[model samples]
Target chain A: MTDVLVVADHRRGDLRDVSYELVTAGRELADETGGDLHVAVISGTVDEFADKLNREGVDAVHTVDYGEEFNHGVYTQATTQLYDELAPQYVLTPNSVNGLDYAPAVANELDLPIVTDTVALETDGETLTATREMYGGKVETTTELEGPAVVTIRGAEWPAAEGTGDAAIEAFDADIDEDALGTTVNGFEEVGGGDVDISEADVLVSVGRGIEEEENLEIIEELADALDATVSASRPIVDNGWLPKNRQVGQSGKVVTPDVYIAIGISGAVQHVAGMKGSDTIVAINTDPNAPIMDIADYAITDDLFDVVPALTEEFH
Target chain B: MKILVTVKEVATVEDEFEIEGTEIADQYLGADLNEWDDYAVEEAVQLQEAGIADEVVTVTIGPEDCEQTIRQALAKGADRAIRVWDDALEGVDLLDVEAKTEILRGVVEEEDPDLVLSGVQSGDDSWGATGVSLAEDLGFEWAAVVNHLEHDLEDGIASVRRELEGGVEELTDVELPAVLTIQTGINEPRYASLRGIRQAQRKELDVQSLADVGVDEGVVDSDLELTDMYEPESESDVTVWEGSAEETAGELGDLLRDKGVAP
Candidate 1:
């Protein structure tokens, strides 16, 4: 049978939600290929992660208690060893920050093809058709590849597997060569803590790339001031140093479920949408009628922000 | 120390565009230096400026059309550039990670630089895999999504802060001969000065074929096939405020006040 092996992701202590989603995705692939779905949990409370990952669809849980946190070298070696032992047709992982660090190395070491950030996957047992986004989520494309391959699924694409499964948990003793490890993780530092916490705000006036210049941010700030709402931004604003990380909303930034999210000139890229999609109300102001932000907006004003924003601020005043 | 930076010219799509078959129509496509690579190039150039790196060379895998984009990197301070292209690569729709790794591996072997800097991912493909894969083939250490890098290379160790989800940064130290995929906001990428742009024209932009880079012609034969492409269907039932800028603003303001979100 063409078995599927999924690697779980965890950071600090808790298992990431994507771990369960990987189980769901792996189960779907396994069902399609008429094979068993095996999950490999490497490092950081492996037994606990494996236990939590033993959802209804999983056939087996492989635990490798290697380190306290994620280390790419350990993960790569342990995962490579597990792949050899299981001989699975597909290796599934979360297309997360940690996953990016090692998934490519694993694919290269195994000499297998890898398609990352896949939103959907289907297989006929001979070929895998993966659906992924390109050009910053402007277009969706279907990529096909045959034989055994490595795939990393985007977060929240598949529902998390539920209900406990009666599966055998095996301890995988990985022979990690200490000398081969060329990197050292010193520690982790929590950033984006400063004068303000945007996560707790009730209303957010978030601006994006269309603001054009740093000076142009004054209009957004004025609108936020008039409405007595917090001023936040998409990645480009923070990346350009116009806003602090604390005021940025995105996957890497804080997740804000504010009562109202006002997006100005934001195309609402998936990463940016992930942080604020849960807001009670979303309003977008942009010239592009077909911008991705409009799809998620409750109310949209398709106009120039420089003109619309000031007029909106006057209404609040 | 010598540092090599991998640059790419990404295709930018227009706001409203048409997908003809599996590709966007050429008329709707525009090319620019990949956004993430700009930060990587800046990092390498800063390392050279800080006296930590003696040379900053760039490598790109693209056709002659991308030379202008590569020159943008050179203008920003990369000493020289190497562009790897071949007639065999013209028709490959998707240059899979393996194919890119093999080609970059060929270049790395030839150059044998102390450090390799690349973007976390490209703007168009967003595969985000080439850097680490190339490192694996070269038997080098790798760190991904690095936002903060320490310029001081004490005892051949490069310290960096890897930006993880939820504003957490992992502090790591990698040995020499490593690849670090630079993330945005690592540094402010400088613009090309007029003099630098003129000087970049004189700088060596060595073009090589697959054979010249010691890569086989078959390396372009990627396993991944892009079968279909289309715009994603919008799932929302949004109420659009159609009118002049002031009218739309009034509609938004009315909605915000009605929702008790505005003063």
Candidate 2:
């Protein structure tokens, strides 16, 4: 049977949510096309992870533990060698920093067809049809695979599944070229040294260009404080020197799935949407209701910002 | 002071794209610069303007049509551009991520750049996979999704700030002559000014071939290939909410929250 392979991503030991999403989507494709779903785990003692994969409909888990930390060369070599051996019909990966770098290399080596940022996938007899977001998620396009395929899926494109796979863990010895790859991780030095989980926040008070001046941002900070929320902004605010670039949100910014995202004085841009679109609730507070942010917003306050923001902050208090 | 930048000409698949018989029915995109490389070109220009780099050479591998994108870069003020020509490469998938990386590795060897810059990704197939692959081949220090970047040629050091969850990833002490994949907002990528565009028409574009570069392209045989290209599918169902201000706000919020996309 044709097999679908998913390369799972993780930090120290535990698995991330995106891995499960890949399995769910991969399983769907495999089932429809008379194929079996497989997951590749490049980690340390990932038996628990393999069991978890089985629950997500994976037929088998290819586990390779080189060390406690991640090394690109190790993973790339193992994956490349495994694909050469398994010769699966389709290879799937999470569209993250790791997948973007190496999936193409393996696909290139094997001369396999590859698609990235796929949100939807289907099969028709002998072909694979995939969907990708374009123009800031404003449009979606379907693509047919040219041959055997390797692809990466955007985050949140598929929901996690509950269960039913063989869950067998298989460890394979693959040759890796260590000399060809260098650059060691000395240790983890957190950026800005903040342990905040922007992705899991309960409330997000985000600002965009609507706030106008850097000084005016204090008004937003006040509103955020009133609701006890964190502050975020669109890419333009940072580009204009109004806010630190770290506050910007979009395709290039942090992808947050917060419970409530309050866009104050922000006109939602496409890049911005790619980051926050997955949030549980989106509230747009802009003077122009026709702004792009309104299209996806659940609550929009259209009065002049000078009038409404104070009202929001006041009401929250 | 030195940076290697990779850019390509991608004919964006636009117009009425359709799928017929497992093939991507040709949609007329006409020829234009690949959509994502513009950000790469712009990022290189910004680094030079910000006084981050002493030199920036824009590079690409393709036919004469690829020159269109090279000049597009010159129009925005890149110092020089390199075009690796191989007429036999028509429809060979230079747009593919792995193929593009192999092509770039050749240029990197000849130029010996301190830093290699490619568009965060390309537009065709729009997969955004060049920086990682090139970085892997060269074994250079690298970073992607760069919103802010800084480099010190004298110390052979680079610092990149990537946008991550909640805060930022400020990676320092990264070696110079590294590979950088830039994000869209890196610096409000400048457009080709009227004069700049006109001047780019006359800029020197050095053309080289895979054979002349001491490399053989035969190693990569097209294994996984595209038998067809076609238009994306569309779903007709619509969920439009209409009403007064509160009614609209409430309705939109309810819909989003109902979808578990909002609170």
Candidate 3:
């Protein structure tokens, strides 16, 4: 039987939603290969989250209580220590900003080939294959990982499992030398001190470079006002000082999965969609019918945005 | 402030990249700066214009051919460009990112840059992991997928906006001489202008060899061996929606839910 390991991705003392998704992914791999799902959670107190993660499919949870927060060096070193001992056939992680930071170094150190932004992971016997979206969102590429595979599953790609299983909890003594960490977190800071950050918005009405000027942003803001939505944008709008960086959406900006995402005048680069594709509903209001945003959008208005936006704003109002 | 902006030479993002089975062939493919890295280069240029940084120096590591991308950065108003050329860096381990990082680390060590930046990910392999890796290897404070950056490195602190699920996080007062990986919404990666393009042609570039690093011809450990590189298999039959928005939404909802993707 193959052993599948999932690294529990958490923030603060609270567990990330993606960690539960990883559990579901772990369950799938374990079931396919006739092995138990062994989840590795690195935190200050793993017990605080055990009850929340207790599910039917998971065979066990490996809790590594290191600190209240996350440090890349400590995290990389700690995860490496676990991998050395477990030698998992498959390793799952969340494709998140935090997860994005440390997963590569661990993969490089372990001499493993990892597929990132993976939407799915399936196994045939001992061979574990992961599928990820490439070309931003145009193509889906699947790879058969060589060696002990590492993969970052796109958050929300797999539905969280509802089954509950009290497999077991184990703690292992892995040497974590503080001296090995080159960087330490003096303190943790929230990105937005207290402002209304668009990434948290349930629905977003975003603008792109096509808007032409910052002053004209009132037009998009009007749309946002109509829908009771927050205003967001692509990097151009933010860089031009039309909007705050906090309002930008894309790989370089933020990874957002809003309930509804509406794009006005955005061309839809892969980077932008990578952050927003997880949205439950997408609408594109662009003049270009071939715009990349239109491909993934559930509703597309292919006329001049100047005309459509005003009309849509009026309709909403 | 001196900002070190890094980029990679990759097959054009929209070039007809032919992926055959498990192998890809770059036949008739055009070369350009990776789009994500372009965002990094553009950000560096903007910082220079805004007087946030005194100068922007671009560094690139790839085969000898990567100089083109560096040259492109120079054309985009970069003060100068540095290219580390090595052919041995063909696989994932020795080439492109790892080699680029190795060269960048040396450049940063030499220049003691106030800020180091990179694109969130490169189009070549689409591995959105380099910025964080470089941050760790160089022992620099690192932040991933930042949509915004505002800081005074002289104060040893920086502020960045991290975009997350359903909101924006303001990661303020982070310590300086940090590495920030820029995502798409940080800046609109600018295109090369005519006057700038002509000036870039005359720019001086520093082309260094691995020999300069005392490692001689080859120094990469190549932790991961490339088993193969190929085109991806199609996941399912394509269903192009050609109907009204209501109809398309209804149809897509059914398909996605049927595929167990929708709630």
Candidate 4:
């Protein structure tokens, strides 16, 4: 039977939610290939990390105790070693920064084809088909890999795996090449001093490219204050330095599942939607009726945000 | 030190795009340099201006028309431009990361640059794989999604900060002769001045065929094919509210209260 391996992603001491999402994706792929689902976790405290990954549908948990933080060299070497041992038909990783760092190297070393940022996957016997969006999610293209491959799954596309199980945890050791470790992580610096965690906010008033100038953010902030909501923005606002990176919501930003997400003057690109589509309520305020944001919004106000925002702020107050 | 930047020409479709059979309808504005690559070109030019690098060379793998995009880069201060194309490459699927990576690998081999830079992802395909894969093939230390970059030419090391998911930033140092995939917002790319544009037109825009780049015939075949291309199904069920801004706001506030979203 074919086997599918998922490389779990973790930062600090906690397993990333994408790790469970990978499990969900792995289970489906394994089922399709009639294979067992295996998960590999590489960290200093492998046992502790592996314990948390004993979820249902996983047949085995492979643990490799390497450095504390994610070292691309360590991950690439360990994952390649594990792939050799398991000979799985498919290897899945989260398409995060850390995962992307090592996945390409591992695939290159093993000469295995790879597909990045895969939003969906399917299998027809031994043939694996992956679907990823292009042109800001405006176009969807389904692709098929020629053979066994490494694929990075986008977060939130697959539901996080749930329930616990007594999966066997196996320890694996790899001979890492010190010479190949050309990059070293010095440390992490919080972009906005780590004060705001928009992911946990219940109500998010997110702005985007249409906000025009940095000074216009005052109206958005006032509206956010009136509703006691958190202020978040799309990538452009954060990139333009108008908003701190922490207050940004999108694929490259934070994935927020707020109770209510109000998108003001934002054209919802696929990247932005990938992060906030899980919100229970979505309200879009834009002048363009055909703005992609309006397509997914529960309530759309096709008027200038300057006109709509101030009135909304006044009404809420 | 020679720095190499990879640019691409992408079609910008602002309106709704139509899917005609297996391909998208050709109803787009003329091609231009990929938006993300502009940041890479800007970074490379900045490094050159700072005397961190002796020269900045730009390359792209596209049709002959892509020379226009290369000229734009040269106008922005890239020292040289090379366009890798072949008549055989016309029908190859653009989304095939492997084929694209191989082509870029060929370019890297020929240039032997001290540093290679590319946009984190392309504007059209957005595969986000070519640069990293090329780095792997070249056995160079690499960093992806880098928003901030600084190089210590004497020490032969580069410091970079990655713009990761969830707004987390990680600082990493890589040895020089590395590949860095630049993210957007790293810097504001400069516009081409009239004099610069005129000078760019006079600069050599070299064209290299796939064979010239050592890519054997049929060796650059794509592993992945685009079986279909279409717009995603919309999940939106929006209720467009109409009225004066004030009235609409009042209605929205009442609705939010009814929905228990606001206090």
Candidate 5:
């Protein structure tokens, strides 16, 4: 029987959605290994987080009330200590920004092999096979590694575990060495506020790298003007200073669920898709027929955005 | 202050390509400097220009074929370069994080710098763990996904803004002699100037073997193994408008009008 231990993630008083998703991932692995599923919620209203994380498949909840916000040193210490006590076969965490900060350190501290951003996992007791994407989602690969490894799962790949449970919750006091702590979190700030808020717009005309140059953005602007839509963009455009940070849509920028999102010349990377996948209607205009944007698009024009966008603008005029 | 930047030459695939076994066909692949690393290089160069950093060196874990990519960093104002490679690493399909951490640990130990800057993740493997993993091995502080770094390192502290999901940025202070994984949009990575490119030819780029770096050949034995590779099947059920540009555009316009989103 190989146990699976999952760490829950939360930010600023609320449990992030990925925490529940990790539960679902943990439950599936536990069912395969025929072992109990353990969940650890460290810091920030630990009892509340533990109650919420007590989903159907969880067998126990371990709370370590260490700090108010995420400190990698505290997390690495607590997780490693838990691994020592429980000796679970697998340690799972969300492949999130916070997860990236600490997961690798925990793996290093424990001297375990680490696989990150995995989309799928299957274990036959000894060897664990993880499926992840490479080359910006162009390809998927299966990686196999021996047991007692650390893994991080990407967001939204698994359904969030639901239903209340009668799981045993306990407080696990972890010894935190304050002298060893190196980083300090000052606070958080909300960025990207400007003249326009794309999230509030009914329709958005978003452009990406396929536009080729900064000057080519004029056609996208004209299309948005003709359709009474707001102009937004993927990361490269914003990174290039062609667009303001506020107009960028992605994991690091804004999440827009407009009534219509017409992605012109945009290959929808996973981070880009995470922001706009919830739009009521999605349209893609790109030369590459196999671009990832097409996967979630309601309608698409598999042609040059330069030609298609101008003609589409003319139709609106 | 001395700064060491970890650089990589990543393989880029064309839109239309074929997979041969567990690898993309070599014919359709092109090599370039990792995008995020460009921003990291720019940050390091800017720090040097600001007079805060006395030297900026770059280290890479790749073959001699990656010298051109390393020179790209040198052309962008990095002082010197170190390339770590060995015949033992020639046949490994995928260099896992543990192996990479050990190889990089060897370099970090030799170069004992005040700070380290690396890309948040590589363009190809995208493991996104090497920077922090290296920090842990060496017992140094680390901050990942940092976008805005204050040039002023007062009291031996580095203040940075970590770009989080949904437009939130976490302000954090990391004690110096640390590692920072740089994010994109931190700075506009300048194009290598003609004069800089010419000067880059004269810059010192040293190549080292595993033995040279004090890493054993056994480090090549990675725990992670690549078993399968394929393109993700298109799960799209999209209605593709196939026709001339004007025809398809007209179809999109009609749909917009019918949906009451356009005039």
Candidate 6:
């Protein structure tokens, strides 16, 4: 039987939501392969993290106690050691900043093929068929990979795993080579210190390329104020210097799951959708009724954002 | 110090893309330098201007047509350009991250740069793996999705701020001769001036084959096979609102209030 291994991702002692999402993905793949699902958690205190991951669909939780924060050297050593012992058919990780840092090194060391930012996966006999987007989500490509590979799943693609069970927890020690590590973490710096974090806001008023110029952001800010929502933007607005990078929402920016997300003049590219698709309710105001964003929106208004935004602001006020 | 920046040329497609069998329609408006790479080019140029590095070399793996993209980088202040291509690579699946990484490894070996920079992800394939995998092969320290970077030539170390999920950023220090995949909006890339463009035309634009880079043709074989390519299906449960702007806005507000999102 082919087993599936999922590497849990965490930060500052908290398990990331993607860890459960990886379980959801791993469970499905494991069932298809007629095998058990295994989870590997590497942290300073493994048992605390391991206990939280002993949920249904997982057969075992492998814990490796390392430094407090994620260290690339420690992760690489622990993962490779775990892979050697488990010898699972597939290893899955989140396509996050931390996951991507050491995943490639592990794959390279093991001579395993890897695919990144995979949105969908299916089993074809012993092989795995993965789906990803290209051209800013304008095109979708389905690729078939040989078994016994490593893959990174995109956030929000699969629902978070739920239900509970008492899976066994096991600890493993890794041989970390200090001399091999050439990078050191100096600490984290907030992108915009003291600025409102749009990701934490319950309601978001997000503008896109249609905002046209920096001066036009005032209207968006006004709408945000009326609703008590925070103002965010798509990548183009940030790239143009119309907004700070911290305010951008997309694959290259923040992945937010606000209660309400109001997208103005946004075309809803796959990259942008990957970031905010988890919003409880999405509303789109665009001139094109056929825009991709309209398809996923709960409520889509096919009117000029200039007119619709002000009207919405006035109505809310 | 020498810095190497990797650039790519990508096709920009608009509405009505035709799928000609296993390939996209041959006709395209035009090709330009990949948007993300522009930030890498800008950072390299700025580093050179700041005297952090004396030479800025740019490289790409594409057809002869990609020279246009290299010239654009040179005009942006890159000192030289190298294009790696061969007939064996023609019609090769571009999403082959492993093979592409190996090809780039060949170029990096030849350049022997003190620092390597590339876009966090390409606009076309968007795999976002080449640079990191290359770093692995070279046994160099690396950081991905870096937005802010500073180098200390004397100390032989570089400090970078990486953009992570949920608007969080991490500060890390890596020994020199590392690799960094630059994120967009890191800096504003400068436009090419008339004099700069003229100077770029005279700069060295070297074209090398896979053999010249010490990579065997057989290494181009891809690990993954493309089964299909198409547009995604649109969501079917969308509710399209039709009314005047004011009326629609009122309806939207009512909906939000009913959903308990608005007070």
Clashes of each: 0, 29, 24, 0, 0, 0
Rank order (by DockQ, best first): 6, 4, 1, 5, 2, 3
DockQ of 3: 0.21
DockQ each? 0.57, 0.24, 0.21, 0.62, 0.57, 0.64
Candidate 1: tens digits of C-alpha lDDT, residues A1-317: 67999999998898887899899999999898589999999988888888898899888999998878999999999989999999999999999889999999999999999999999999988799999988877789999999999999987678889999988899988999989999999998877654465766889999999999999999988898999999999999987888878688975565677889999999998779867876888989888998989888988888888889899888878
Better of 1 and 4 by TM-score: 4
Q: Interface RMSD of the predictions, in order shown?
A: 4.4, 5.3, 6.5, 2.5, 4.4, 2.5
For B202-261, candidate 6 gives per-residue lDDT tens digits of 999999998999999987777788888987775647788899999999988988788787
Docking class of 3: incorrect
* lDDT of model number 6: 0.84
Q: What does candidate 4's lDDT look like per residue over A145-253, in tens digits?
A: 6668889998778998889977899987777777888889898877774757788788899999888999999999999999998999999898778888789787557
Q: Which ten residues in a row have the lowest lDDT in candidate 2 chain B?
A: B229-238
Worst 10 residues of 1 chain B by lDDT: B161-170
Q: Write the per-residue lDDT of candidate 2 for residues A85-174, one digit (tens) a residue.
A: 777778888787656656765665565667888888877535777787654454566667544788889877798867667677898776
Best by DockQ: 6
Candidate 5 lDDT tens digits, B5-79: 999999998978999999999999999999889999999999999999999999999998999988999999999
lDDT of 3 by residue, A103-196 (tens): 8777766756556777777778555566665555545555664456677887777888677788688876657777665444444434332456
Model 6: lDDT of residue A298? 88
Once fitted onto the true fold, the runs of candidate 6 whose alpha carbons sit more than 4 angstroms away are A193-202, A209-228, A239-242, A257-259, A267-274, A277-280, A287-292, A303-317, B236-238, B243-246
lDDT of each: 0.90, 0.69, 0.70, 0.84, 0.91, 0.84
Off by over 4 Å in 1: A194-232, A236-243, A250-281, A285-292, A300-317, B240-263
Off by over 4 Å in 2: A12-14, A44-54, A163-166, A170-176, A241-243, B1-3, B9-55, B61-78, B84-94, B102-115, B123-125, B134-179, B184-203, B207-263
